[model samples]
Target: MFFLKIRSIGCAILLSICGQSAWAFHKDVYEPRVPNEILAQEQQVKSPHPVTPERIEAGRRVYFGVGFCVTCHSKDGTGVNLPGHPPRDFTDAKWQKLRTDGELMWVLKNGSPGTGMPIRVGTDITEEDGWNVIQFIRTFGGK
Candidate 1:
């Protein structure tokens, strides 16, 4: 009886470890990608450029061109299947509502942790292009 109990406990431990590793591969979609230290301040930041048709068009050009966002996110913004963690689904209304432009900009400037995302604003695109692309992203959610 004691041996059976020990075996059960061992199995539980193994399951727990496996579960944690699986969870580590994909981050919670709703969880803020921003670090907690500056999340509040970052959330408050706003885009200097207002949403406009011209700006959205410009953003589209960047997304399809220099941004290289299409390679991973796909043309429809549904995101492609990736190895570690799947890219975010921009079409999700809930996710669109929860995220702010500032937070998106932060992600552009600083690659999201624990995922495949990499920095793009400073390296590939200008800050203005980042904000414009954010506006274009919002369109996927019909916002």
Candidate 2:
């Protein structure tokens, strides 16, 4: 009976921690990942590359290939739920509208804080590839 009580308490504590963390992730879905100091400038920044079918296709390749974006964002861009925080749901129209290509690039270059996203551009992909991937991500918004 004592052991059962201890186990129950442990389980309850674990559940509370997990629940709070999940809530935290969902609560900040629309919050800017970029730091406030540079967010405005970043938002104003535009992709040098034009949006063409070819570039979008190339971006798709980067997302699924070297960028390894598919691992977290998933095939459908709905994102996969990981342990600490759920990945961004690219299918979210509001989120797509809220984020800019340059801001996305910033996240790619500098991984999002308090999340699983790692520095991707300089590490695995190039700056151009990052821009291309942003174009590809915009497709998820159906834009």
Candidate 3:
């Protein structure tokens, strides 16, 4: 009886793992033009930010409140960690460098489809807010 119980438990665990859906490595799927936002594979779009202190501050407000970026990206934009998904390290200068303003805008508007990032569609969030968030993300380095 004990052996059977152990076997059944193991089978159940295996089934659950196999039955689960796959997690997206990249959050953006709406950027049809980019066609390469498969995070870790290759960047389809670019990141946008003016790298100014003022812009960063404004972005911080949107992120923490209106944008609700904190819920998943976390308070520091370091990204939230979970099973089957890797966390985004906002501090990575290399990653920041590769992103372009246009790409960032696309991500903001459409969001990464498969990832936890929300599309943020039809919201009052202005383009200025998006750019500001970029600035704030740059500050993630915390200089």
User: Which numbered prediction scores highest in lDDT against the true structure?
Assistant: 1
Give the alpha carbon lDDT tens digit for every residue of 33-135 in model 3. 2445444333443434446677777888888989888877887667888565444667766666666556667777876544545566347477768868867
Per-structure clash totals for the candidates: 0, 0, 7
RMSD of 3: 8.9
Worst 10 residues of 3 by lDDT: 25-34
lDDT order, best first, reads 1, 2, 3
Q: In model 1, which regions exceed 4 Å deviation? A: 1-23
Listing every candidate in turn, what is its Cα RMSD in Å to the true structure after a full C-alpha superposition?
Answer: 8.3, 6.9, 8.9
Which tens-of-lDDT digit does each residue in 47-114 have in candidate 2?
89889999999999999999999999999999988877788888889998888888899999999765
Task: Name the lDDT value of residue 30 in candidate 3.
Answer: 34
Error of 2 at 19 (Å): 16
| lDDT, candidates in the order shown | 0.90, 0.88, 0.64
lDDT of 1: 0.90
